[model samples]
Target chain A: MNTTATLSRIFAGIQPELDQVDALFQERATSGLAILNSASMHALASPGKRLRTALTLLAGKLNHYDFGKLLQLSVAFEMVHLATLIHDDIIDEAATRRGNPTVNALWGDKIAILLGDYYLAKTSGLIAEIENPRIDHLFADTVATVCEGTIMEMMTSGRADLTVETYFEKIKNKTACLIAACSKGGAILSDATDEQVEFLHSYGLNLGIAFQIIDDILDYTEDQSTIGKPAGNDLRQGMVTLPLIFALQEASQNGHQQQVQALLNSDEHNEKDILEVVDWVTHGYGVDLSLQEAHNYANKAREALYHFPASSDRDVLDELIDFVISRRR
Target chain B: MNTTATLSRIFAGIQPELDQVDALFQERATSGLAILNSASMHALASPGKRLRTALTLLAGKLNHYDFGKLLQLSVAFEMVHLATLIHDDIIDEAATRRGNPTVNALWGDKIAILLGDYYLAKTSGLIAEIENPRIDHLFADTVATVCEGTIMEMMTSGRADLTVETYFEKIKNKTACLIAACSKGGAILSDATDEQVEFLHSYGLNLGIAFQIIDDILDYTEDQSTIGKPAGNDLRQGMVTLPLIFALQEASQNGHQQQVQALLNSDEHNEKDILEVVDWVTHGYGVDLSLQEAHNYANKAREALYHFPASSDRDVLDELIDFVISRRR
Candidate 1:
């Protein structure tokens, strides 16, 4: 099966919830102003795989989380995700996303930025409708953490001193925090015990870390057409991700440290040089080491499921851990 | 007393609460990233009159709202306001605010935009701490409305077809809604009856409407250096305000239709012609009519307090209405 079909298989149990989220997006991503309405509809027209929403739904399987409330959280989480992507496009100066022109590309940075703010406002408003204080605080704090993480990443870009700990911390804030919130939110909505809630949080945390590491790896391994961005785009933008971090450590003894350091120090890099760097990182034990890290986190994520009784939901969630590490893009 | 002293006097009863809000700002505007932390601190270093926070404090007097809770709401509201202003400075291409360089000026549009989002996330997180769903909903809904209003304003900016009604609607969404939320939030935090909450809403609504119109009027009547921007800057930015709307109609009736039309259609406008348009608008019943409108709303704001029993809070609130109309800045 193709990636989309395989992912759909993984999320099959939440198909109905996903459909409701689509309807919710159609109904809610609107404004009286023409420009805002158009910008929102355009952004909504194409979306990333609804993995975060599915996380919320899947986390609800055992607790029998109220479908309506879960759906609201799902939609809100997705919107916040989309808003961040839109903002990220501006920050990345990305020309496209998922093979479509980015909002920033189509509407310019100003409107793109405002529309992102609008979506965030809508997300917070949606979250406010949920009355549980824990869920309320979780999403809000997660939003703050996510922005802080991005800012921190921006601050750290181009620096040679990026530690493994700093990389993990940044990813946790930027990527893993929202995913963890999604999991915790589902449990908080249900009748789950505190222990159950903690399990899901840890599950999401590890899964998100693995997921981002894979994305970073894909920057080296995947083709530009498939990834919808230039290969090594992260490196070109002065971002040092997991794969590169590992490669740099290896390069210290492997005699490629000078090559990697040259790329990092200079503001220029040709496509050929980028490809060669990718080869050095990917072939010279970089991908293997990064994959090793990804699997470690993925394994830890699966281990969190040990808290719950065996069931089909657990089986698929367990399967999702592998799916995260294996996905190409 | 000067405007600042008079306003301080009006807020005298809530001085302690306001001081707590200041402390809260200092405590909360920090971030892990030095850039974000410094940016937030710089934005907070000079704040406009804390009128909205005072409204929250004043509204709480009747129900004896918890000081701690009110402080959270106050800080959140002020941050949201500051976030909007930061975003607005980018939109307006403003160089300075309150005689200090704007965040956009200091750090460029990208940082300013993200910092605005940062402040907003901070606001949402702060509000989430307040367990009252009504207050939560109020702030969230107000944020969306404020953004919508701004988009509407941007869309309507250069258009000659801007109606008085549209202007009212835009200002209500952009300005009045937040102010109303400030008032209603205070009441919500307190144990006020539904009727009292509604009155506070109305009071803020009218006061906010008057506040914006006076702001618009000041654009034309205030000195270029004293106002910290060029006189008639709003018209230059293609912003159609109350005074301009009145002036336009007067210009049309006085057979200056061609002159006004030329000004609207052509981007080129010498300072001489801009000053002349100001003369037509301000001298020909613009300021008077605008002031009249301001007083009308200010009076209605006072009328909302008719239901409240006489108290020191009520007295200060009544005086604040006058302050809205008569303040030079």
Candidate 2:
């Protein structure tokens, strides 16, 4: 089977799991403490693509794991992701997310902080009910890794001189660790063999890296409205992702280093500067190279799953890789 | 054994466990994560009396339980408590806690929120390592309860008309639940009877309420240096605690309702207004009444331990009740 139908089937399997997220929230969250319900529900409304949850469910289905366990892990993984978002908004002082006011924006930092705590607490409660220490430890460790990744991001912000090695470490922590854990967690629950778990782990890590690189690419290529945040928002905040890093490198070679430095040193950078950087990165032929790198990672992600039995699930996995590389935003 | 000697032994048992807290930080926390590490350590240094941890150890010892289980529960309880403080500081916009600058104050709300998340993630990790599912579930549920309490506190802030019943619910979530859980968790890990666990739960709940009431009282009576925060800090933020509830009751009888209304209504609430409210509350015998309630709770807390065997551990538990009523800050 070709990749398109495969992805459609993967999306189909994810639908019911998304539905289960609400029920899990209600069951694990009824503390009878006031305002908690409202804050929690409000946070759940944040318009994320539910990427990590989808990854978990799709990976589990591809491995032919139990739907019940997959649903539980999907909810747990989503809660962890949501918890991170709640904290991130506070850090960024961001008022709007997904084109809506953030939790911190609506309620203030105090409530936002408490709500993040609430999400993690509820996540722990839900995961604990699973009654498997192995799963519990994996989930907990992933949370630690995510924290370490976030700390790296916080420290590295504003450093134009950040190395490519440091950049990969940050993305691996912030983006890939949880994604990898989602599949590893699914495989662990299904009692998959070590080789099967490792395969998915590799697939998840590579795909996650490719996914973030695509996100960085989109920062230059997409409209702000389409992205729900400003284009080059990361650059404005001093976060130099791959495309910007590559753009700076090319600009230096063309003896336009002063122009690039002037943009970074400006009192107020505007869209013109952003567009200039984008043109340099794209028109200079760096986009081809960056896209090639992304394709290589996506291809590596697919190759990691070659050990799996040839089934419809594996076909769906291949489609996900294609989707990862081709998606616009 | 008298209260002083009993309290001494409990403190002695907690000393080693307190040392363990340092190791927990040093191992799980990365040194290179400077902001995260500094904020965490700053919060940890001169930690809050280790009351919850002491209670866990004392409860276990009184029941003739092993020390190892109590130590784990103590660490878990303390971690949970510290995590809540990090989040609470964000909610309160608090500048200081335990006489030190708050995480939010020192780092900013962003780092505070992330650090709080990290502590909670670590707590879940530690708890998941222990084999008992009952204890695991209890930790998770307690977190949810604490979040509920924090949310209620946030919702009620700047709400001068908040009732005493509402205050009770808030304290139950914010303070009592985890304190209650610490004792109950210790008992669960040991061979304590079901009745024994109930006794400890009741004792902890009452003691937690009493402890908070005394804290509220001190908010009016204590010197600024001793309290660390300024007196009437809660009232400045428009919080109506127990003393205010009682004073409002008495103000109604003296036909000085207009004066009371002016105090509550003034947009220019300054040090004078704060001092005058404190005077009015103390003048109307409200402070004494609040203290009386605290004493009643102390008595009830002691009664909860009557089911336990006669031992110094039980005596320490008893003295802890007295300490709740006697603490100056």
For TM-score, the strongest prediction is 1
In Å, residue A171's CA in model 1 sits off its true spot by 0.8
Q: Can you tell me the DockQ of model 2?
A: 0.71
* Tens-digit lDDT string for candidate 2 (A1-329): 33334444556745667667557755654456556666667776754446677677667766657867777777888887877887888888888876778888988777777777777887887788778788889888888778888888888876666677888899998988898998788777777777888888999999999988887887777767676776667767667788766666665544555565566667588778867776777666556667777898898898998878787667767777888888765
Q: What are the candidates' individual DockQ scores?
A: 0.70, 0.71
Model 1: CA > 4 A from native: A253-269, B253-269
What are the RMSD figures for all models against the true structure?
A: 2.0, 3.4
Model 1 alpha-carbon miss at residue B74, Å? 1.3
- In candidate 1 chain B, where is summed lDDT lowest over 10 consecutive residues? B251-260
In the range B234-260, model 2's lDDT, one tens digit per residue, is 787667788887887766644554554
Docking class of 1: medium
Q: lDDT per model, in order?
A: 0.85, 0.76
| Reference contacts preserved by each model | 0.61, 0.78
The CA lDDT at A82 in model 2 is 79
Please write out the lDDT profile of model 1 over residues A1-329, one tens digit for every residue.
Answer: 55678888888877888999888976777877788878878888775548888888888876776888888898889888888888889988888887889999998887887788888898887888878788777877888888888888887888655788999999999999999888888888887899999999999999999999999999888877677777778888888888887888877644565566667778767778778887888787778898999999998898897688998888888888988888876
Give interface RMSD, per candidate: 1.1, 1.2
